[model samples]
Target: MTLEQLQTLNSIVLHGSLKSAAEALHKTQPALSMAIKKLEAEYGFEILDRTGYRLGLTAPGKAFYQKAQELLLNAEQLHSLGQHLASGNEALVRLAYDAVCPHNLIFNVLKKCQYEYPQTELHVFGESRFGALELLQKAEIDLAISPWWPTFHGVGDFQALKIGTFEILLVAAPQLFNGQAVTNIDQLKSEVNLVSEESELRFDSENLMLIKGACKWKTRDMQTLKQMLLSGLGWGYIPRHLAEQELKEGRLVPLTPQGLDFSIQGELCLVRREESTLGPVASMIWQSFVPPL
Candidate 1:
């Protein structure tokens, strides 16, 4: 089928009716209905259950719609690749980082790219968990530096390099635990545990790494979570570097209890789609992830 027909079908599914899909596509209802009829005629099966007041996809229609989505995705990727080739240079490099990506390392990478790749434009944004991964999947960003690993198989031909290791420390305001070491997971359940929202990047039960079944105050940013802990709202696992000052000043105390390791290790990884080749400038930034001599 034609791309227009596929896109029309997608709009019908999204907007939930022929009239709404027609309005969205700026096409008349008759034209939209005719397109679906053509597809049904060629396939020898009804694509939609039109007997209802609203249009709904039949079993075959649902399956065909999934294939249409894949076709649309590949078409968009093909267009982007063509643009990249026509530009001679990649022109723009989009980088996404999670909360745990070391600030010092990021600055170092950017500083070097500034001097070496002055012609290239750099765009940076912060994302946590698999949020950054979602951007990469959509080809919205060139690379992702994330602390969480891919939880599923067949995540495209994405290459990931271990860039650094950061520390995750479970700490709380001194009075949150009433001067008692947190030995059991259940002890913190009653208290609000400030934590990042559950993310798709977590392959393991890292949520259970902390106090399982605890009432959690979910936050979008790790810095915010640290602030919540500092305010005595809850306790959570904060990166060592981010909480260094509080730990040193005695505002936040690291939990140390027998049989419970409150500290966990986290890896900072550089991720990118393997199919896309980086320009010289983007390649320079990639190399900056390496340690200095």
Candidate 2:
């Protein structure tokens, strides 16, 4: 019914507790509760399921929450537009990318765009590659940076523009190989230490790490695996970016026999859903990454 009510609802939905939401909104619990009740009565809809310790939004509440977010974003954008009108015409382009994707994809592209057209803004969200695809499908983001793979099964009709490709490498602590080299899967049989990625882990389902007789050592995150490698506990397939510094300093060794590295053919792509209004900023950012090649 009101902006205050919408803000309160959104906060409650985000924080999942009346007390925390009230604290975030700088309102007393009783006052917040009363305001929510008034809004519910006016809208004739139940928003919060507060009969428990953690309050959850009902179905209607979820819908209202999304609408509220869009409204708030519009209002904020309008305010920003007013400031830009007086100053300059700069607006942010939103992007979400996978962790393994090249870090400089957005940065380099944005730098070029700014150099060519300084009146534009850039906002980047680095996340899992699969998650980036979801943001694209939901129209929550203008551009998504991911590897060359169909994220959702059977959605092969999506458009993708390849930016560049990088190699995936294998790394192990110096002690893991006893100062020698590891080549084929036979040498790695049951000897391989399967270090797993914990953050942004949307892409690793379906036992993708099977290597002959390798013993799996699945940790919840990369830090653990990194520590394991540093401590000479096991071997892992690390992204070249995550290990290039270590490899350069001789902390880890390349396991590809030639003492080189194995490559998984990683590629960066700029993507948008088929049905969406990609503004001028989105098109420019995409072109900035992939030109007339």
Candidate 3:
């Protein structure tokens, strides 16, 4: 009938007795009984089985309680949403992050945001290479976390904070080279090279560290590229974090060609467009990474 009445029933079911429910709900036992009685009288059915020593729901009451529980959850969310709107929090915030960014770091920030802004919906996207930057450049997302390269300065007018660093190691299963260390790039000339490509090919010209003459296989994300490398299909660069265990287990081995750098470290930055103004929730997330002064 009312949320309070449904809450009373839920409390009784949870606590297993009217006396305990009364103590929990701050109502007298007699009043709790009258509430259940009123509900049964209106519905023409017993809502609780009084014959048992401990209180239990009747067969029909079980079904009714299930629906009531759903209603209570929705009501709680609606109340939170009302408070969120009253406080002028944005309804939604979108974030685009590079696949190479450490997931735990991003999730930790998001966990804090969720607790502080329960009603603000967060939409997250995992992108490859310059994918997140491209989305931010187009004004499609409120925030982005991606590996920052000097070439990115030419992408757009943007501001960034150096949140962390990411290392990409040139790796492949040892079987690719018959368990021998590759001594020259010529050894890979005939082999298929796994490469993770950007979603929109907007920064294809900036593809550094790629084996120039190798037969190339393009993947859309790092996981797929890692899988291909693990399968001995080709050698490619992958985030060091993603392949740490594999490297330890000798499933993947780092490659060192005669003159090529086998590993590269770049600044992982949280970026936003210079001209775009962020909403309250988005601004909160952006400020979360600011160093304490």
Predicted structure with the largest lDDT when compared to the true one: 3
Ranking by TM-score: 3, 1, 2
**Residue pairs in clash, model 1:** none
Which tens-of-lDDT digit does each residue in 45-105 have in candidate 3? Answer: 9989999898999999999999999999999999989999888888989999987798997
Which ranges of candidate 1 are over 4 A from the true structure? 1-87, 148-154, 201-210, 258-261, 291-293
Number of the top candidate by TM-score? 3
Q: Candidate 2's residue-wise lDDT over 1-293, tens digit each?
A: 88888878888888988799899988999888898899989889998887777898788988877888999888777776676555544376678886567676568777776775554667777664256766676667778877666554345345788887656667788787688777776666646566553433355553564564678777645556667787887777766776778899999887774433356666667787766665666777777776673
Instruction: Give lDDT: candidate 1, residue 44.
Output: 94
Between candidates 1 and 3, the one scoring higher on TM-score is 3
Lowest-sum lDDT 10-residue window in model 2: 197-206
Candidate 1 structure quality by residue, lDDT tens digits, 29-73: 999989988988889998888788877889998898889899999
Which segments of candidate 2 are over 4 A away from where they belong? 1-80, 83-92, 112-123, 138-140, 149-153, 189-192, 195-204, 217-228, 257-261
Candidate 2 or 1, higher TM-score? 1
The Cα RMSD of model 2 versus the native structure comes to 14.2
